[model samples]
Target: MKRMIYSMAIPLSIALSANAQDTIPPDKLYGELFVDVQMNRIFPDGKTFVDCTAKRSPAAIVEDYTKIKKAPTADFSLKKFVEDNFDLPLAPSDNYKTDKNADVQTHIKQLWQVLKRNPDKTVAGSTLLPLPNSYIVPGGRFREVYYWDSYFTMLGLEASGETAMIENLVNNFSWLLSQYGHVPNGNRTYYLSRSQPPFFSLMLDLLAKKSGDKVYAEYQRPLQSEYDYWMDKTAPTKHVVKMPNGDVLNRYYDQYETPRQESYREDVELGAKANEAVKKARYRSLRSAAESGWDFSTRWFADGKNISTIETTNFLPVDLNCLLYHLEITLSKSYKATGDLLRANLYTQIAEKRKTAINKYLFNAADGWYYDYNISGKALSNSMTIAGITPFYFALAPKERIEKAAGIVEKKFLKPGGVVTTLKNSGQQWDAPNGWAPLEWMAIKGLEQYGKNDLAKEIAKRWIDLNVKVYKATGKMMEKYNVENIDATAGGGEYPSQDGFGWTNGVLMQLMKEYPTP
Candidate 1:
C-alpha cells in the first residue's frame, strides 16, 4: 500500500489531490490480521471487521497485535482480539416500526427519513469516507450511499417532491469525483477499487430536469472526469477493451486480484481448491461482477449456473455500454449548452462511434436483442438478460430493433408479477423469478420511448401491483422481488433481500404517479 498520512483537519480535496491521505483498503490496513480474522470466521460477515473503527491509532493497534500474537499467550481468541482492538460496525436500527395501515406511498415517504443519513464527520480509522452533503442510503446492511442505486432512489425523491435531496445526492457524487477522480461503489475505503456503474451523468440529468440545463454546466468537469476514468486508453485491460473489429468499448474490472474485503470469506472458500493463478482469476471475476452491480449473477458465469465459474471481466456488458453512450450524449449536450460547440461536436462524434460499435458488436440479429460481447472469446455472450433492453432504454436502438426487443421482453422475460431479470433460473438473485425496481423502471421507460405505451404500462402496472402487494403483506419495500412467485420471499444471493430499499421506493413512487390504481 502507498504510504501517506491522514488528518481530519485537512480539506478532503486537498488531502486527496496532494496525496496526503492513503486510501489503502481495509485488508492492507490490518495486514495478516485482516486475513486471519476473515479466514477463521471471526465475524459471520467479512464486512464486519472491515467496517469497524480502530479504537486506537492503526500503527499502535498493529504494533500491539504483532506483540500479542508473538507472545506465549494461552487461549488466544481471535474474536476477542478483534473486539478489543476495534469498535464494531453498527447494524442498521430495527427501531423503525411499520405502519401497515398506511397507504404504500405514505409508507414510502416516511421511510425517506428512516433511510436518510446526515453529513458525516471523518473518523480516523473508519472505512466510511465522509460525504459533504446529506444523502440517502439503500438501507438495512448498506448504510453508505451507493452509486447506481442512488439514481433509482432519486426518482422516488423527485416524485416525493424532495428535489433538495436529489441535489444533495448529485453534489455528494461530484465531490467524490473531485476527490478520488471517480466515484467508488460506495463511500468506503474498501470500495475504492471499483465503481458500481457510471450513473453520475444520469444523476446530473435528474437534477437538471428540476433545476434546469445550468445543472449540467455546473457539473461539466466531473462528467468529463467520469468518462475519462472508464475510457482510459492508458490502461486498456483495466476498463477498456478493443474489439476484434477494432472498436473500443468498456468492461467491468477491478485492479485488485484479492478477495473482496466485504465478502472475503465466501470468495476464499469458493476458490480454496483452485491453484494460485485460478484463485486470483476467480477473485477478479467476483470483484468485476460486483462492479456490474449484479454480484454473483449468472449473467457473469461461464457455465450459466455456478458463481464459481464467473468470467465477468471477459465480457463487455450491454447495459454498461448503453450507460456510457448516454454519458457521452449528456456531455455533448452539456457542452453545447455552455456554448462550447467544438467539444460538444467532438463528444457527439464519440457517441456516434460508440453507437455504431454497440449495434455492430452487441446486437445479435438472430435474437433481435442486445447481448454482452465476449472480448476474450471473440463472440457474443448469447446470455439473454433484462440488460438486453438497455439500448432501447437509452433510445439508441433502431426503430425496427425496438419492436423486436419489446416483443422478446413481453413474451420471454415477462412473468406473472413483472419482468424476471433473466430467462435462466440460475438460482442467482439477478436471474429468473427476481425482478429489481431499477430494471423495471428501465424497461418501462425504454418501451415508452419507442411509443410502446401498452407494453410499458403493462410492465409498470404489474411491477407496481407486485410492490404494493409486498408492501401490504410485509409493510416494507424490498431490494428485489420474486416476480415468478410473489407469495415467496426473494432469494439467491450471499445476503438476504434488504428492506428500506432506496430504488424500490423510488421506482414504485415514479410508476405509481404514471399508472395509478383504478
Candidate 2:
C-alpha cells in the first residue's frame, strides 16, 4: 500500500459506544437536520448490540453507531456520543439544537426512513424531505443520492453513529462503477459534467475494511470505464487523422460559457498586460478562463450547458493527471487482485509513461513549479496557481523540490486560513484571495506527506474553524471563503457568488472531524 501521511490520523474524540436502529418520527424532527445526521456511521471497535430508536416507528431513526468494544483499552456508547457531541437529550434548539427541542435527532430519524427504502444507494445529507413544489423539481431530481459529497457529508452523519450508511455509500460508488464508467460528481444536473474530488479509491479502502470483501473482478469493469473516460475516451479528437505521438487531448470543462453572462476571467487576467499589438489576439486566445480557474463564469459561454469548472483546461489537468496516476495504480491493483498479471502490468506501464510525460512537460526546474502545457505546445508557466503543487500528490517530488514548492505556498499562496485560489487575486472568485475545498484538501494532505505537519494542521484547522464560525453566526455553509483576507468576502470571478455551496459544506464537515483538537 502507498504510504499516506494524512490518512485517518485524527483521534476519535467521540467514538460511538452504543446505538440502535429504531423508528423515526417525521412530525417531531426537522426534515433537513434529520437527513444530515444519518449520512454516515462510526463505531467502537469491538462491542455488543442495543438496537434502539429516536422518534416513532415506520420511519428509520438510528439510536447507535456500533456495539460496545469489549476490548482492553477503551469503551463508548453511541447514544452517549450523540448526547455529548450534538447536545441531544436537552430541550428545544435555536435552529436544530438538541436541548432546545430542535429535534435534529428526530429529523435524522425521518431522513433515514427514506434511505432504508433504497438499499443500493447511500444516504445523503441536508435532507430536503417533503420538498415544496415551489422550486418545482422532479422526485428523483429533488433528493439527490450524491457520491462525492456522501463521504465528507458522512463525517457529520457519523456523529449520530451510523456506520451502515457509509457502507451504503460504498455500495453506491460500486453501483456507479457497475453502471457508468465512473462516478458522477453529484446527483444533480449542475454537477453532471464532472466528478467531485477523486475520493473513490479512499472510499473503497474504507468500505473494504468494513465489508471485508475485496471483490476485484466485480469492480474492475467500472474502474476501467472511468479510466477510459477521463484518460482516453473524452479527450478531444482535434484531428481528422491520427497523430504519431498516439495521444488524444481534450478541453477541460468550463461553466461560464453561458452567453447570458459570459466573463472570460482567465483571458481578462492573462491578457491584462498584453502588448497593444496582441490586444485582439489575447481576446481571441483566452475567450474565458475556462481551463484554469473561473468557478461561475463557464456557464455563460456554453448556452447554459453543463460545464464543471475551468478544470485541467477543458482536458488533462496537472492535479487531475496526478489523481489519475493514483487511480490507474488502484485499478492495476484491482487487476492484480483479480489474478490478471498481464493487465496489471499494462496499467503499470501506462502509469510510468504518464509520470515520465508529466516530468518532461509539466516540470519547470528553472522556476521551481509545475505547469500545464497546452496541447498547442504552450506551457502555462507564468501564473502561480495551486495547480503547480499538484505534483506532490503523485509522490513525484524529492525533498528539495517539495521544500521549494512549500516556500512558494507559504510566501505566495498560503493564507491565514488555507491556500489561496490563485496568486493573482485578480478579484476573480477563482483567483487569488479566495480558497476552495478541493485545493485545501489537496495541499493539506500533500504537505503532510512531506513532513510539513505544522503548516498542514494550521491550514486545515483554520478552514474548519472558519466554517464553524460562519455556520454558528449565519446558519450557512458557504461555497468558498476569502482565505486571503479574513474579514473581506472572496474576490474575483463573476456575480456575488452563492455561499451555501454543497461541496464546501461536505469538505468542511470532513475536515472538522479529521482534525479534532488533540
Candidate 3:
C-alpha cells in the first residue's frame, strides 16, 4: 500500500571512448525516437496528440491507427491496454516484397523508403533511419514492439555505433515503466499477462553507463515493481500456478493462454504434435509471464520437453536463474547509484546469497555445469541451454568453471552467426541452429568479463562475419540467422519468422557501432 519515488542521477558525462557524440546531457540524450505505434495506443479525436496510455484496438486489416477504435477512460480492456501501451507504428512489417525476397531483408527494408538512408536521432541516443509514412502509417510492426526481439535489436544498435540509440531505448523502456508496471510482450490483443527475460535492469545498466545517465534510479521503483510482479508470483500457490510439482508455482509464470500445442503450431507442427507426455505437461504447466513469442514457450524448456509449463520443473535453468541473479545485482548497483548504501548492501547480500544458493543447490558437480533442478533439488538430466555464460557478467563463476562452460559453447552451442538458442536442435528453436543476437553479445561480454577476450573476440568475429556475409548476399539483416549454414536464410517463429525484427535491427546497429567486425 505504499508508493515510493526514486530520483534519477544524471551524470554530466560518461566516458564512452568508443563512439561519436562526445557529450550530451541526460535530458537531451535520445531514448525513444518518434514511433507510430498506431494500433497500439489510443487518443480521442478532439486531442491533437495521442495518449500512449490510451487503450485502443486494431482497425480493419491494418488500417491507419488513427482510424482504430479507442476506448474511453473508463472502458480500457486488457486487450486495448496491451495494444496501445507498446505499439510500433509505421514499421514495414512486410519486409519482403515476395517470398523470394526473404533472404534479402534488412532493417532498412522495413522502414519508410523515404527515410531509409536519412538519419535521425532516436530517444535512445542513436541516429536511426526514420522511415517514411511517419503519420501516414505502414504495413507491419504490430508485434515487434512487445517481444524478446528488441533486447537483441538493441545489441545490434550497439554493434553499429549507436550507443545513443541504446540510451534512448533504455529511457523509453524506463518511461514505459513509469507509465506501466511492466512492458508487455507486444502491442496486441494477446500479450497482456507476461514479460520476456527481466533484462530491463540489464539494459538499464548498459544505458546508465553509456549515457552516464543515472536517470536509471528514477526507474528503480517501477523496475522493482515489475520485478516484484514476476518474483512475487513464485510464492507458493495451488490454483493452477506454474510449477513442476503442480503444488508450487515458481516465480516466473502467471497463467496459460492457448492450450499447449495450439500456440506453437508451426514449431510443434514440424515435429510430433503434442504427445501424451507433452499433453500431460501442458495441462499440468502454468506459464510464466509471456515474453516475446506465444505458447507455453521454450524460454523455460530444458532439453526440449517444453519445461515452460511446470512452474519450477526447470526450476534451476542456468540461464533463467543467471538472468535473475543479474537482475538482483543490477538492483543492488542501482541502489548504490542513488546513494542508498544500506539498501544496496542488503540487495547485494541477497543476490550473493542467491548466487551461492544456486551454485550450491543447482550446480551439478558431476555434470560440471548448471542445470534446471527438480523440487527435490536434483538437476534435470539434459543438454538444454539455459544461458550458462551470463554468470561471468556477475563474477559468479569460478575461472576454471567458466572455461569449462565456455568450452561447451565452442563444442556444441556456438553457431557461426552466434550461439544457437540451445543444444537440443529439437526444432524447439530455443534449442538450436537458430542463432540469436542477444546471446551473441551475452557470450561475447561474458567471455570478456572473464578475461576470455581472445575467445570472446573469436565468437564475435564469427558472428560479425556471418552478418556481413549475409548482408552482402541478401542486402539485409533478419531476426535470426542459420548458423549451420551462414549463407542460408534463417527460419522464424511466430508469423513467418519475420525480418525487421526490432531487436535484431537494434542489436546489429549497436554492435556494428561498437564491436565492429574488424
Candidate 4:
C-alpha cells in the first residue's frame, strides 16, 4: 500500500488563491433594513425574513428602503413591500405528505429525497453561502446544512447505503472549511459569527470507514484548519481557555456580541429591559449558547430559571471539550496513517493532555457524573445535564468513573420514554421532558462503551418505541420528543416542534436496524 502524505503548509497558499472570502454576516450586510424588519416584526418568525431571497440586489433593496422609509406614502404597506421584494423561506417538507401506514424505514427512505438540497445557485442577495455539493438539511425551517446535525444524519445515510451522498456531504463541509477559516453553524451568511459543535473530524472518520484511509489525507488540510480555528492562540481567553493550573480547555463562543440575525426579535424582546452593558452581556451569552446547539437550557443560566440570567461564556462545557479531544485523537490517527511520526506524536500528546484536563476539571467522582466548570468562579457548574456522558462516548472516562456515571444516568436521567435532556424543568426545549435524537444516541453509545448494555438496550428500545408511536399518531417525525409523557407533544421552544426532522429519522433508522423487532 502506498502511504499518501499531506503537507501541513499548503492551506494558507490554497486559501489565498481560492477567490473566496469569509461572508459578511447578514446583520452587517443588510444594515438598518435588517434591524428595522426584525424589530418591527415584519414576519412572524425573525428567521423567515433573514432567510428570504431578495428579488433585487441587497444593496439596491437597502437603498430603496432608506429612501422610501424617510418619506412614506399613505398606501404603503411593509408586508406588501417585503412580499414584492423577496421570496419568503419555505419549510423543506411543506410540499410532501407522509404515508401513515408505510413501514418506518420505507417512509424515511422516501423522505430523504424531499429533504435533500442540491448545489445552490448564486443568488444575488441570498444569505446562503453557496455550496458546491448536494447536502441534507435537518428539515422544516432548517433549510441549510448544519455542522453537528449532519454527522448523526449520516449515520442513517450509511445504514441506507447512501455512500455517495455521505461522500458528497463530507466534501461540502471540507469546502466550507477550506474556503472560510472554519465551518460556520450552517452554510448561511447569518451563521458566520459562530460555529456549532466541532463534528468535522467525526464526519471525516465516518467517510474514511466507507472510503479508504486516503480519505483522511484528502481532508487533512480541513481537519487542521478546523482544529486551528478552535485553538486559536491569538485569543487564548476566548474559545481556547487556560485554566488556573495552566491546563488548556475550550468553551463555546461567537465572534459578534450583537443579537443573532435569525432570532433577532426574540433576543431583542428578552434583552429589552436591561441596560446597554447588561444587554450586551446577555446577547453574548445567548450567542455562545447558540453555538453549543443546546441553544436554550438551564445549563448556561446563572439563576437556572431564566434566559436573562445566562452565563454561557463563564463555563468550560464538558461536551465541547470531549469533542475537541476526539478531534485531537482523530488528527493523531490520521498523521500515523500517513507515516508522519512527528506530527502524530504531537497530536497524541495534545489528546493525552486534553484527556487529563477533562478528568481534572470536568469529572465529579463523589457525585458520580461530570459537569461544566465555571471558569470565572473556579468551581464545577451546578447544572447536571446529559452532556456529562460525552467522555464515555469517546472512551476517555476511567473504568471506575464510568460505572458511577452510568449509575447516575440510569437513576436520574432515565425516564419512561427515554432519557430527558436535563433534570431541570426550565421551560427550555433542551431541558426536562424533551428527548433529542442526538443526546439519546450519545447516551446509548456511551452506555454501551462501558459494558452497560442492558441500560443501553433499554434506552434504544424505549426511544424506538416512542418514535414509532408518534409516527403512528401523527404520520410525521419530530425534531424532539417529550420523553416524560409518551402521549403528549414536545413543546417549549422559541418555535413550534418541527416536523420532517432529519436527526430523528436518522437515529430511528439506525436503532431499528440494530434492535429489530421479531
Candidate 5:
C-alpha cells in the first residue's frame, strides 16, 4: 500500500483565483474576433479563423472595425484590417519537400534546414516575439520553437554535429527566461500566461556536456529565474501542490480556463456541453493538459473517454514531478559549479525528499507501475501510459523497480509500431494507436538504462519502421504516428496530424544513429 495519501489542504479561493487568471480574457481583442467570426462567417471546425487571427487587443480591434464601418467608402476588408494591425504567425516554408527516393536521414537534414526560423520581424501585428538567436521550429502548423520539443530537437541537432545551432537554441530559451521570467509554451504572446514542462535545466545540461560545465554558471540567473517562476505562489505557479508532510510536488496546470486562442471553437463547444458548475474547471484542466505536452490523453480524463471529465489540475502527474526532480538535481549541480555548497546542499536535500515523496505517493506497488496521484481523490489513476517509464529515463528509480517497470511496459504497452502513449483507445491524439516521438525516445532510453537493451532495440526498430513506412507512403514526416494500424494515418485531436514535425525528425535521427541498419 502507498503510504502517502492525498491530504493536501488547498484553499478553494486560491484555486478559483488561479482558474480565473487562466481563463481567456472576455475582452481580449482576438478572442472577441474569434467568437464573432466563428459565430458568423466561420463555423467552428476548430481551425479556420482562430489560427489566422492577429494576437492583438479586442477592444482596439473593435474600435478599428467600428471606425472602418463608419468610413465613407464602406470598403472594410477584415483581412486587410488584420494585416494592418497584427503580424501573422509563420506559414509553412516552400523550400522543403520530401523526396521519396531520398533516405530518411537526408530528408531529415533537409527538413532541419527548411524549418529554421530567424528572430521575429520588427513589424506591428506580428505574432512572433523575437528571440536573441535563430531557432529550429517543429514544422507545419507549429512554426515556432516549442519548449519541451526543442530538447528532443536538440538531440538530433547534436547528432547531426550542429553544435552552433544547439547553442543558439539555448540562448533563445535563456532570452525567454530573462524577458518573461519563464519560458512560455512557445514564443507567441498568446502563450505568455502558461509554460510547458520545465526542461530548461535539461537543455542547459546538454549544452554544458558538449561545451563545458562553466555553461551552467553562465546561465545560473535565468535558471534560477525559471525556478522562481515555477515556485511563485501568486499566479505564475499554477501546478504546485503542498504535501501533507509539508513538502511540495508539481503538477501540470495552465492559467487560462477559456478556450485556447488556437483551439477556441473546440474548447467553447466542450465547455458548453459540460455541467455548468464544473465547466470552468474542466476547461482549465483541458488547457492544463496542453501544458503537460500530452494535450488530450485518457490519463487526464475522469471517465477515460470524454473531454468533459478532464480534471488535469486535480492530479499530480508522475512525469511532471520526475522532470522537476531532475531540475532540482541540476540546480544543485549548478550551484556546486559556482562554489556555493550551502545552496547546493539545500537543493540536493530538496531533490532527495522529493524522490522519497514521489515513490511514496505515486508508485503503485500492488500494480508495479507508477501512476499519477489524484490529489483530489487520494488515489492512483488507473491509466497505464509510457509516462510511467520517465523516472527510469532520469535514473530516478531503483534497479529492481526499473526492471519491474520494464517487464510491465514490454508486456502491456509495447505495440506493433512502437510504445503507445497510453493503453486506452480513447479517441484522443495521445492515446493508443498514436505514438509520439518524445514518448518513444523516453521509453527506449529508460529501458536502456536498466539493461533492457533487446527490448529497447525492438521498440526503436519498430518505430523507425513505422516512420519510414509513413514517410514512404505520404512523402512527409508526421507529428504523430498510428502505431496500432501501421497502414492507416494517425488521427484525433484539435486538428489533423501536422507535418514539419521537429521532434519526429529529431528522435528518428537520434535512433538511426544509435541503432544503424546492418
Candidate 6:
C-alpha cells in the first residue's frame, strides 16, 4: 500500500531546458514545494508531483522556476511543467467498463490486458527511480511497480497464460537487485531506505515451476544478495534480532528515522503531537510498519488503537521469519540444483534452525495460535491476525498445530465475506472489516496445504464473491474489501480505496481457476 501525495494541475507558460542535472535531494524537493503551496490544492487528495517520474526532475522544476521568479507573470504550473518536460506512462484502456450482465471471469480477463504496463525504458528523473524490465503496477495512484504486490499479480498472469509478462516481472525484480542493494518498497527513490516483505524467493520459485530448476541457477546470486541485505551485520540492520533463546530471527525495520516522503503531512502532524524525545522512534516505527506491508495495522500498535503507539521494531514478527525461512529453503534448493552440495547443506541447516526457532518463539500453546514475539517484553502479542496462518502457507506448521490454528481461524477470523485481516476491528486498513487480496490468498492456500480444502474453498468462494459484487457495483477492483459488510466500500485508510488494482485481479483470477463454480 503506497502513500497518497497530492499533485496539482497548475497551468503556467514557462520555458526551460529539458536536460537538467538529476541531483536534487528528494526530501529537499518535497519540503520546498510543501512549504510554498498547500499541497492539497495543487494535487487532489491522492495525487502527488513525485508520482510523475517519467517527465521532469524536482531539481529541474525548482531550478528553472527560481530563474524566472523576477518576471511578474511567471506563474508556476506543475501540470504545464510536467507536460513540457516529461512523457507520461500509458494508462489502462477505459474500454473495459464493467459488464454488469457478464460473468465475473469475463470481466477479469478484460482487466488482465487493461492493467498491463509495457516495459519502461525511459529513465526516471532524480525524484523517481527506474526499473530495467517492463512490469505491471498495482494500479490507481500506484503508477510504479511494487515489491510484494508483483508476486500475487504473477499468479493471475500465470493463470491468464501470460508467461512472458511473468518472466518480465521476475526480470524487473532481478534488475532492481542488481542496481540497488535491495528492492525498495516500490520503484521510488524515496523508498530506498527500506523494503516491503521479501517475496523475491517466492517469485523465483513460481517462475521456476514453468521455466525449470535452471531458472534458480540463474537467479541464485540475486537471491543471495537479497538475503544478505536482510541479514547484514551492521548497525543499520535493526530488523535482525538475537532472541533470549539464542536464535536469530527477523523483525520489520526501516533505516529512515523521519517522516516518509509520500506521507509527509500525516507523519509530521502525528509527530508534532508526540514528545520530542520519541519523535525519531515513532517515525521509524511507522516506516517499519510500511515495510511490513501492513502499513497502519493495529497489529503493530502498542495500544492496538492509536497509530502513535506503533512499536513494530519491538517485536519479532512471525510473518517476516516465515518468509526468511522460505528464502532459506529456496536458496538451499537453488544451490542443490546448481550442484553446490556444501552450500545447499549449509542453507538446509539454516532453514531447519529457523523452522525450530519460529515454532519455539512464536507458537502460543494456550491460545492454539501463533503470535509475534515482543523481544523487549518477552511476551507474545495478543492480536489475532492473518499472519498466524503464514506458517501453514510455507508448510512449516505441524499437522496438530495446523488443525488447531485452522479451528481458531474459522471460529474467530472468518467473516461472511472472507477471513478478516484481524479479529480486532481497529480503524486501520489492515484490521477487521477489511480483507486484503494477498492475505486472502495466503489464508486459502495455507489451509489447502494441510488438506483443509473444504475450508479453503469456502474462504475462496466468499472472497471471490465479494470481489465480484464490488466490481459489478463500481466497475473497479479495490485495494482492499470490507468483508464484514459486502455492500459497503472499504474505509479507514489515509486515502480513498483505489482501482486499477493488480493483486486483486491476480488473486481473484487464480482462485476462480482453482475453484470454479459448476
Residues 440-471 of candidate 3 have per-residue lDDT tens digits of: 77777887887888777777777777876776
Q: Which portions of model 4 miss their true places by more than 4 Å?
A: 1-22, 233-237
Best-to-worst order by TM-score is: 4, 1, 5, 6, 3, 2
TM-score, predicted candidate 4 vs. hidden true structure: 0.95
Q: What is the Cα-based TM-score of model 2?
A: 0.60
- Per-residue lDDT tens digits for candidate 5, residues 1-518, read 11111122233234333434232233364544546655444433433343444456555777766666567355755656655754444446546657889988888888878898876654334345667677998877776789999999998898888888888888878777655567778876567667898888888877887878887777777777677667663344566788888878888777767677667666777888667668889878888888889889989988778878899998898888899898888889889999999999999999998898888888989877888988878888888788999888888887889767988888888889998888888788999889999999999999999889999999999999999988888888899998889898799887778887789989999999999988
Tell me the deviation in Å of residue 501 in model 3. Answer: 2.8
- List residue ranges in candidate 6 displaced over 4 A: 1-25, 34-41, 53-57, 63-96, 99-101, 123-126, 233-235
Candidate 4 residue-wise lDDT, 1-518, digit = tens: 22222233223224323533235556776788889888999987788988988897777887888888898999988788888999998888988988877978999999889999998888777889899888899988899999899998998998898878888888787777766667778898878667889998888888888877877767777788788878873222269889888899999988767888999989998899999999998998899999999989999998888888988999999999999999998888878888898999999999999999999989876797999999888989999999999999999999888778888888999998899999998789999989999999999999999999999999999999999999989989899999999997698878888888788988989999998987
Of 2 and 6, the candidate ranking higher by TM-score: 6
Q: Residue 17 deviation, candidate 2, in Å?
A: 50
Which model is ahead, 1 or 6, in terms of TM-score?
Answer: 1
TM-score of candidate 3 to 2 decimals: 0.65
What candidate 3 gets wrong by more than 4 Å, as runs, is 1-144, 158-168, 178-180, 233-251, 257-314, 492-494, 513-518
At residue 416, candidate 4 shows an lDDT of: 83
**Each model's RMSD to truth, in Å?**
4.3, 17.7, 12.6, 2.9, 6.8, 7.0
- Model 1 TM-score? 0.94
lDDT tens readout by residue for model 6, 307-358: 8888899988998999999999999988998899999999999999999999
In angstroms, give how far residue 248 of model 4 lies from its true place: 0.3
